[model samples]
Target chain A: MDETIRTILAEHGHLPVEVAKIGDEDDLYQAGMTSHASVNVMLALEDEFDVEFPEVMLRKSTFESVAAIRVALGELTGS
Target chain B: MSDAGLFRDELVAAGLLVLTGTDGIYGRSSVYEDIVAAVDGLAVGAALAEGAVSYRFPPVMPRQVFEQTGYLSSFPDLMGSVSTFTGNNADHRKLMDVAQAGGDWTALLQAAGANLCPAACHPLYPTLAGTLPEGGRRFDVAGWCYRHEPSVDPARMQAFRMHELVYVGDAAGATEHRDRWLQLGVDVLASLGLEVQTVVANDPFFGRVGRILADNQRAETLKFEIVTPISSAEHPTAIGSSNCHLDHFGEPFGIETADGGVAHSCCFGFGLDRITLALLRTHGMDPGDWPAAARDRLWA
Candidate 1:
């Protein structure tokens, strides 16, 4: 569980440090991610996890933290 | 449509200063300023109703950031980069030697790590991501947009103005909002007497998938634009675009609502320069004798 969480964070953590926890819900924009950083993280997550992000999930509220993104991906892929 | 020749004559009669030059820049005259002021007044008036605050963005951006955004991959045809050298006289002479020999001189000098911003959205994303609210939100923005299209037409320039109506809501809501604005936008242009047509468009993302994506976009009707013929009477020019970004931005910014849901986002952008071109074509360049209705809508 820890490794999987770290992997996810490694792929999506572009915001400033300690912004949130692996499984805790936090705001991505509020936590300090810039728009350019957010785009990089999104493209990275898609590449690393081999998942295509749906058009509906592309907003500031979705990439709040690892937990939120994981929840979004799980729902999208039904994993 | 107004007669093109008569419109030119009106432009002359109005004493609108026109400077014909071989250098690419055009339409920076007193009349152009008048047009910009009029458009800005209308935008500010509309914004007051929505409680949107004003913002200004710079015209340049970080090079690495742009590369990460796929700009280099997509718009190599239109993107320009800043370049510089750091060495002393010896290094400068070495660079000149390569240039004199006609070798790979460009590779010798380091890229300046800066890029000319092609659109207003480039800077906006950073600002939005920096100061986004707890839930989803919206913004009304106006910025000078730039593109290096290889054309001498006065209508098509390296720099122009863009007015954007942006909304950050849930996915369904964002899509609906964009559609609503598309219809309203048509009425706004028609009220000024410009003949326009709405068509699907793509921002030309990079690579093979980009081509497929653009094609599928048209097939699926994911994007649409308001266009009219100005630069060319045959192929219409895009005056405004209503874009639905689905989750592309949501996944990046982490913008969510109280229910722990990722908000969907949409934006509608009007190319003020292109719109001016359309208006010039439709209403005639001389504002002095413009249709009484159009004048009242503008000056008043």
Candidate 2:
């Protein structure tokens, strides 16, 4: 799940720097992922996980870092 | 309640506004129209002084343009679009029958190719999708903007006129443009006897992830508003705003700078009717009795 989340961020994040350069808990927004890019990221995540993100999970922190995304996906996927 | 002199009700009593039986929609009286025009002129003059080229647009924008701007995904709740009755006679009969029966008649209309413009700048982006000149360009644009927010508060109108000065250029130029107008918006309104305050602000982006988006915008100091007491002092209405869109439009529209980098953009914008309301709230409904300074500044 973690690897898959990183792959999605790399493909959809639109970050100025490489995903490899970002740490597990580093700020994606600070790394140049724009609000629009985050929307794209969320959509991509939904497609990959086959789970719709409930409104309660739709927040910045839900996708703030790789670890955060992994945790949210874990809850949804029970992986 | 009438004796308490509510501002919205007072405008109706003075024949400055006609009730439309809708909370956010109102028919403008000649007096209200005159005031709206005067306030729009004041904002226009500020842009015109900077040699900004002017453009006028209709209230609706192309559906393609709306989609490209990402307003749909970010603000679907407030977004509105045109729908048309493109059905046959039989379909029309059904629609009418449904309507007469107090059923959902709107299900018959097909989606039109245009969306009601939420901002005046939405139409301007497509025209700006190219490499800029040496120092970039300034455009003064105006249009009727639509949002689906219906409210009993007179200041928060569903349809309003926005007069904006937009800049497309480098990142530094965009931020500088926003900063310059942030001060200008307050100064000009204050000169007219409005109690103004410039505060950091954000657009009402939709949903929860939008919270992060809004926070990032505020953290970067990307938006500001010149607010004044329209209905309440504690919850002042935003009469004018400055936004720095750093390549937000450029990336999608391919607007490039002289240096071949993505062009940055900014807008110094205001709502015409809201400003008129602020003026009325500050002074009175009658423009003739307004202070000479305010009157001269507006009519001059």
Candidate 3:
């Protein structure tokens, strides 16, 4: 899971050091998640898991942190 | 490239010039006949698979249909009606005919029957109501839509062509259905080498209830939009959108699934014109220099 998170962050996260220091519950937008960056995050998530994120989960809150996104993926995969 | 850049480059590549209109109707100097044909072909090929049929809708619809759907009350500013004019002799004859036979010709046209179809989806809804299949159905619709906007910016137009991919099905099915198509939209654009941002967005409908519903539904149902950084970075142009109307249209339209329950509906609409512009912006207008992968994917 840490490796997966690290890969996702590397691929999608624009803020390198901040993403490393922050917890999963922190807001991505507050940490500078532009619309384009968030989309990159979504694409990375889809490419990593090979599962489509439900239309209902494409909100501002879902990309808040590594942990939040992990939680979302867990729910989607029922892990 | 920005809208201005795309506007200029596409014109040159296609042997066009930007001509301003006296009536303030902005138009391309290029002959769009080929462009329209190319877009239609690309859209049809990419969107529809084998065995999918095509359907065309009328340019206008009855006013009652929109009223029932709550669009008239919600978006009255954008609504247009076909108004009738009766002159002196003709008006007198009609008045006498009404007095004698108790029927007025003016009332017929004035009845809730002359509203303009502001968006392509308006006419599709009434036709789809109570006539949908037991499971679900997909529709490929294209039409000329009207809006009462006061913007001269090329991005925001008073009249436009809309190509929509609509899906009607059960609740979870509908959400998943739109999600899948939304992903397809992203993939298609990426293949074109356009850097798009799929963000959470609300519908353009205006009203207190509409705003509330948009916020609540966008949060819970996840209405994602694939937008390009055009016009401004803060407010980018929403080139594509995925909507999951969970039973909102179904209950009103009497659309149901095989399980005898109202089904949720979803749609993924792509503004074809915006996509063309985005492509031109991303990869310059020179077809020769355009990305090989993008051209192959789109031309495929």
Candidate 4:
């Protein structure tokens, strides 16, 4: 799951730095991902996992880091 | 060439814009002035036909009002406060010395009592606080608005003009007013031969927490913008927007409707400069070369 999440981030994050170098706890916004880019990433992640982000989950903190995204997906998929 | 590059070149070639070696600051040529005036006249005429009361406001308002509006809380980064050189003779000498030394001289300036108007309808709400008549109130307001966003995109300038029609009334009436104007905006722009689209939109709120606010706004469909390709087809610019505040302003300002309930408010804002740029982008540089329908619509 971690590898797949990293792959998705690498594919859709639009970050300035390589996604492989970022820790799971690292903030993606601090790695140069903009708010607009974060929206793109969110849409791509939904497509990859086939899960929709509810209104409550639509926030900066939901996509703030790899860990936060993992937790959100875990809850959605009941992992 | 990119769309932005082409538009920039056309603006210079036609003398619509006078560049000042700065990203956002520029002088408007007479032709540009004429086009802006014509657009404003048409828009104001439409508002007047809708029984809108006209009010012209200065570009700057008292800082106290600015703070009371909660603009600073949402968009502190974009607010441009006025400042002045309130220095004595010695401070002036020091300022000159710092300037001659190629050091920062703006430190001598103190914050003035006012901030540049961020939105044309901001000052109107406070003035309309006390009471309302039978139906409600509608205002046709125009003002030069300022934001601190200095960008290279001509469509996104630091200073621009906005013509706004604001409505303050009951929720159903205000929403209906906004809906009507949204369609009117599309029809007017389409008559000018510009391809326009209206979509759910949100303001650029500040910081991480602002993300939630933006999402809630879009979810509620509180705002919509009339978008056209001023910069690029992929990333079109919003030339006009319609917003429903839904008692956000009324509760704070103590605005009461005829029924004594808090009034809901709505506003339709047109970015005059961006619309002109959209015209140039869609229909080449020369006014003579523009579509007959667009030319006739503007001239008529």
Candidate 5:
């Protein structure tokens, strides 16, 4: 799951730094990922995981870190 | 500078906009004024024809009215409040002295009775709280709107003018009004010979929580913007937009529909300056040399 999330981030995150360097709890926005880029990441994550982020889960905190995203996905897929 | 940047410079050189050494603030020359007048005239005329009552609002709305709109929760970053010095003579003298010494004097001013209107339709809602008649109400409003965004790009400005037509009534009626105006907006811009495309869009809601709001807005197709390439093709600017705020303003302001239910509302906004810039970009800097059809639609 971590590898897949990182792969998706690498493809769509548009981050300034490398995906390998970013930790599970590091702030993506502070790492130079913009709101616009976050939207793209959200869309790509939806497509990659085949899980739709409902209105409740569509927030900056949901995408703030890899760990947060993993938790959101876990909740959605009931893992 | 890119072509779009150079075009903005040309607009300044052509005297369409008078520069004030600020990025977003500019004065409009007579030619620019004439063009804006024509555009606004057509827009207001169309709204009047569709049974919309006209109401012109001041640049500032009462701070209380602004607070009731719940804008502070969503977009406090872009909000601008009016303030004035209400000090005694001694305090005034001290303020003057601070100013003379090149010190900050703004600390002495208190928040005034009003704040700069962020959008033209915000104040309209509270004004119509208990005023809706049998079939609800429709309004044609135009005003100078201020935002805190300061950008070098000509299309984006801190202070701008907007002509909006707002509708208050049943949810179905409001949705139909938005749909009808969406096409009308496209046709209106096309008549001016500008190529436009309508797409799902969302407001730049502030902060982390705003992401959820923006997604929900798009997911529900609550907002649609007619975009034309002004600065870049990759990132076209929204010249006009149609939004459906289903009971967002109604419940807050105690506005009731004809059947005594909370009214669903929608608004169609035209960005006058951006449209004029788009015309300049599509046609030319000179209005006289514009295509006959385009000139006829605007001038004739």
Candidate 6:
């Protein structure tokens, strides 16, 4: 699951650094992921996970890290 | 009806504005124009002293260029695309029949391949599609900006003059420009005796996805508006705003910084019509009754 998330980030995050370099708890926005890129990343994550992020999940902190994304995905997918 | 609606009615009764049968559209009187011009002068003067060049664009821009600005996806509710009667003779006859019957004739019209200028600085981005100079570029861009909102609120005009200082270059320059102009906005409004409060604000992004966008924007502290009591003290209207669009325009417009990176952009815009109204509300409806200090900042 983590590897899949990393793959999606690599394809859509548009971060200055590679996903392999980003740890599970690393701050994605701090690593240069823009708001534009963040939207794309969110869409791609939804596509990959087959889950929909709720209105309450629409925040900077929800997508702040790989661990955070996993937790959000877990809640939606009932992992 | 809001207090602004009553105030708008008063302005119309006072011969300051001509009603055009539209909620947010009106014709400005010479006196109204004078005050708007004075406000424009004050804003332009601030940017000019900092060596900002003056650039002007028409109220309409090519739809192709406007599509790249992400305005359609971001603020689709406010976006206005120009359409015209491009059909053949048969379609024209149909349109005429509909118009004569007081029916919807606009459905027959096709895209005019143009869009109403959403903001003064939007049309300026495409013109800066190359590498900028060492320090960057700054301009005082002005145009008749259009938003599709029709309201009785006098401050929320459908068509209004947006006079802004737009800066494009490195991230530092972009952020600094927004910061500086935000302070100037507070000072400028207060200097005119308007009780101003500068606060973090967000654009009215549309749709479910737009909720996330708005949240992200507010979280970034990228936009600030100088609010004043035009309608009421509790619900002050924003007369001016300073925004930092960090590489949002540069990446799409192909604008590069002097140091060979995606350029960042920022804008400090004054809603001229709203500012004029704020002045009227703050000092009396009559410009002649305005204080000497406020008059000197504008008329002088």
Candidate topping DockQ: 6
- Could you give the candidate ranking by DockQ, starting with the highest? 6, 2, 5, 4, 1, 3
Write one digit per residue (lDDT tens) for candidate 3, span B22-42: 221346534343344456666
Error of 2 at A9 (Å): 2.1
Q: Ten consecutive residues with minimal summed lDDT in candidate 4 chain B?
A: B207-216
Better of 4 and 6 by DockQ: 6
iRMSD (Å) of candidate 3?
Answer: 9.1
Model 1 lDDT per residue over B1-300, tens place: 334334434544555425345323454567767776786677667656776666666677787667654666567877878778877899889999999998887876778888887776665554444334554576777776667774545456677788877777676777886898888778777777788898888777554334434544554466889988775687777888898876555555555654566666787777787777677777776677689887787787
Candidate 1: residue B233 Cα off by (Å):
3.1
**lDDT over C-alpha atoms for residue B283 of model 1:** 74
| Cα-based lDDT at residue B294, candidate 4 | 87
- For candidate 4, write residues A1-79 as lDDT tens digits: 7888888788777787999899989988789675556676787778888998787897878888899999999998889
How would you encode candidate 2's per-residue C-alpha lDDT over B1-300 as one tens digit per residue?
422137678888988877798777889988888888888888788999999999999999999999999898778888889998998999999999999999988888898999999999889999888789988999999989989998767888888889899999999999889999888888888888888888999888887667657866777789999998888777889999999988888889999999999999999998888999888888888999999999998887
Candidate 6: which stretches are off by over 4 Å? none
Give lDDT tens digits, candidate 6, residues B1-300. 778888888888888888999988999999999999999989889999999999989999999988999998888899889999878899888999999999999888889999999999998889899999998999999889999899888888999998999999999999999999989888888898888888999888886677777888999999999998887678999999999999889988999988899999999999999999998888887899889999998988
Please list the residue runs of candidate 1 whose C-alpha ends up more than 4 Å from where it truly belongs after superposition: A1-79, B1-24, B93-109, B130-135, B261-263
Task: Show pairs that collide, candidate 3.
Answer: A56-B221
lDDT of 3 by residue, A1-79 (tens): 6568656776676764655676667766567554445666777778788877776776666666777888888988889
Q: State iRMS for model 2.
A: 3.3
Evaluate model 6: give its lDDT: 0.90
Name the candidate, 3 or 4, with the larger DockQ value.
Answer: 4
Residue B164 in model 3: shift from native, Å?
A: 1.3
Candidate number with greatest TM-score: 6
**How accurate locally, in lDDT, is each candidate?**
0.67, 0.87, 0.66, 0.86, 0.87, 0.90
Weakest ten-residue segment in model 1 chain B by summed lDDT: B1-10
Model 6, docking class: medium
Model 6 error, position B300 (Å): 2.4
- What TM-score would candidate 6 get against the native? 0.96
Cα error, residue B220 of model 3, in Å, equals 1.8
- Model 5 / residue B274 / CA error / Å: 0.9
Score candidate 5 by DockQ: 0.13
